[model samples]
Target: MNFPLHRSSAPLAHLTPALWRRANRHLLAKAIAEFSHELLLAPQAVSRGEGWALYRLETPQSEYRFPARRLALDHWLIDAARIERRVGDAPAEPDALAFIVECRDLLGLSQDVLPVYLDEISSTLYGAAFKLQRERLPAPALALADYQALESGMTEGHPVFVANNGRIGFSDRDYAAWAPECGKATPIIWLAATKRLAEFSHVDGLDHARLMREELGEGTVARFEAVLAAQGLDPADYWFLPVHPWQWHHRLAMAFAADLAEARLVFLGQSEDLYAPQQSVRTLYNLSRPDRRYVKTALSILNMGFMRGLSPYYMSGTPAINQWLHALIHNDATLCACGFDILREEAAIGYRQPYYEAALAGNGPHKKQLAALWRESPASRLGPGERLMTMAALLHIDADGLALLPSLIYASGLSTEAWLRRYLEAYLRPLLHCFYQYDLVFMPHGENLILILDRHMPARVLMKDIAEEIGLVDRANAPPGAMERIYTHVPDELRTLWLLTDVFDCFFRFLAAILHEQGHFPETLFWAEVAGCVQRYQADTPHLADKFARYDLFAPTFTRSCLNRLQLANNRQMVNLADPSQGLQFHGTLENPIARFRPGAA
Candidate 1:
């Protein structure tokens, strides 16, 4: 009963016991630290004698004992070497999958989500092992590496999410070929959708024909048309789009049989250009031509708490949202002062399957099976002597345990304080101005923002994922249907959380930990520098004094939004994207680290 299973047999050769142990230890460290940050676990410090403190965390089914140091904002820094695992006090293998099962009750995971969640956890562990097996690149080498290399070489997934690397729908073969960490170049499958069923939109002056010509050269476009013409299909009636090769093989062929049978969706062969997957697995950069726009596709894989599907309905408004925000940024003096810009989503096309659109619910993932958007490349926007890297690279620690940020800091030749100050001005100041003056905010997470580097220090900030992530709190000031897709009624009190919880707590908390633990700077000095940035911005924008007081950036405490808690409650769809603030899972408050340095505070 032999079967053709060779493709799956050797893909995971790196998952040895030793590498598995290292990956397990790292995953456990993240789970313990992030779960504690979410307040799901209360670790008690116990003296192990000789002036060392070992912390004990207990759930209903298991106990974990480890030595850890506490940092600011209730962060737990677990020493991976000293971690111990047990079931009811008996020693056991350190299995992160088991840990999640043991704490399932405490984490509020439902019975239905437990098994699928475990599958995700195991895949994440495999990803960690694959990363650990790679050749160790020194911090300086990684800091100076080319942009795509650094993007694929990032070791840490999301800093806080335990199941951050879960690409649930990917098989072993798909993981090898498509996962960003695999560092493989994939040639995308091209498909033609009937114009009657698909909606295509682009920014003014950048129409569909021009984009096609620019992306697919005239020769390739003519060849594609010939392929369609041989099937008695007119290319003029069909719109061509790029599809993730995996999705085309695994989903569209099987699920949309009617469309194919009726010749509504015609197949075109692969494009000549190869694409390198970016940090966001769904977006790919054209490796063959660096100046070409990035292609972001609709993938049904579940990752980081939601099915990574681009909604067909939402796609209609994407170009409008990008254009509106682009114009707003160009007109605003405050945003320009910080050298902030966005990589605009210039063109988008979404295929609305008439069958699935009628059968599925409005929010179902099936309705978004085939779609792609073209985003302006940051590479095309680079100025002289400027290069780009995802801000997430700052937290990357090689397998040898050296941090990347210090190398970048040293290469800049600026004192640590001066470099951090410059970084904050580029990265954080625009966030402050957008929130206070315009009542607008971006999901300014590390992956969503690119750090434009000059001589190894951050010189400008380029925000991406624009159409989906930008939110406006003041709907009254918004023009009719400008950003209607993201416009929702967020309460006045919760408006600033787009900055505090998303920016300060989620992103900067780990960054501060990395810098302080690596001896680059003290945590105190880090927060004080942030305080100085806030104070200076407030002083310069005295006209917005009332708005500052209303939002109160210097407030002593802010809501501690629990990210893992939301995922635990419902891993499939943690929060409805339409109205995100309504689904927040709040667990008390975190005293703002910069609160003490507020004006007039001793």
Candidate 2:
């Protein structure tokens, strides 16, 4: 196969030897740390010191040695500068690909999946190099940066996932033009789908026409309609939908060729409103109009273990769920007091291809194609002195080796514990109430939440990417059909894992490590503040005391629900979104960091 990804000279400019080497070093460090944390690779300590050690990982073919600080929650903080790779005593370069290949058997990378996983690793490195190529904003500068800047400045995509930025399907050109790190103002493609084949769902207050008027002003609407009229087609016969330009050219045009040819789907060209991709590649933020709804399209890229696609069948009840949750959460005094809220996915549209619909059994990339959703922006929700930053930025370490959380703390003029407490109140405490009181849980990972900051402290949080990500543990709490898909049948034992695994193990694990390493903050203090937040929430809500004991946040240890293991086991379709509880690959248990802070603990 003659490859064309690098045919354009400038597109692959970031892939210089120097940048590639640096990217390799960084990627390999992460892979080693994460792989070791998951217990996939056991590293032997060569020498040990207080709070740190020199560890060596040996494969049959290669031996790698690095000085690493073993932090709380079994996080290995590797010193990348000192990382050494060797082949029979001769010093070899530390390459992520080479490391993966060496540990292939240990990772259980099957014959079919090995190459694909390596391709993903290469893509991840490609993205890392691209980020390095740009003039990096250090954490201090980034602390004061705007919303989209913070989103773009996030060098590390997902903290835990080794192949975090593996946007595998995106070509070199696509990375330059459309990747989140590129910070390009991407104009989305507008396609009109025949009403017969398209599905549009919106909140009760806004109709399709009004939503159009609000989204695209009356002038743009008229212009689009005029284009439809010029072709002797009535604008009323079709529903105008926005699309990712890549999808329009590569997937939709080819996959739904018959529909396009038969006039069922008409390409109306690009829209005027420019958007910038958020941390989640599929979701785009309105650049021209900050208050405008975010347009998320069905992207067929294989990244972070899933072919990122939006199902039309799921779209039908999206608005209802959001509306329901908005009412339910806002009405709840505890959640509202915590300054917690969600950005509703107010409107959604999905173009159903008849042939694919008939042939496909369930949700996949095929049936999920040609769909879009408009999410409520946090811009309008921000108070006078408040601004927005992705919660992911908290764990962000810029190219200059500065963590944004410390910079944010310094900028906020608050003590580390005070800042930590405020954050927990805005984020973790609200999540605890949701789980303990309402039996609700979201995929409360970093990217899923947008922190509304007052100066540099997170005064409140505006949670986005809802509807699809959220789950109701108690199916009874949902309004019958509203949460049919959102209902998670996690056993009573594993329900605490939502807080323990997702929050503590996945998110706070990295956050704690970053705080401890970047700033002089102690790990025990971080957990103490977290514990205090939970204690206060519990104290305030005495009625939920029984519920709290049942799903104990202060449990000694919780099941280690591993992210890398899930992706390593199956890069594609890591977990079925519909029944996510079924696919959890639990190797062992993690000592809950907050267990010491439990009431009456020694």
> Which candidate ranks first by TM-score, i.e. highest?
2
Candidate 1 minimal-lDDT segment of 10 residues:
1-10
Candidate 2 structure lDDT:
0.87
Which is the leading candidate under lDDT? 2
Error of 1 at 371 (Å): 1.0
> Which residue pairs clash within candidate 1?
none
The list of candidate 1 runs beyond 4 A from truth reads 1-9, 48-52, 88-90
Report how far off residue 123 is in candidate 2 (Å).
0.4
Tens digits of per-residue lDDT for model 2 on 500-527?
8888888998899888888899888888
Clash tally for model 1:
0
lDDT of 1 by residue, 520-588 (tens): 587889888888999999989999999988888788898889998887877889898888888889998
- Which residue pairs clash in candidate 2? none
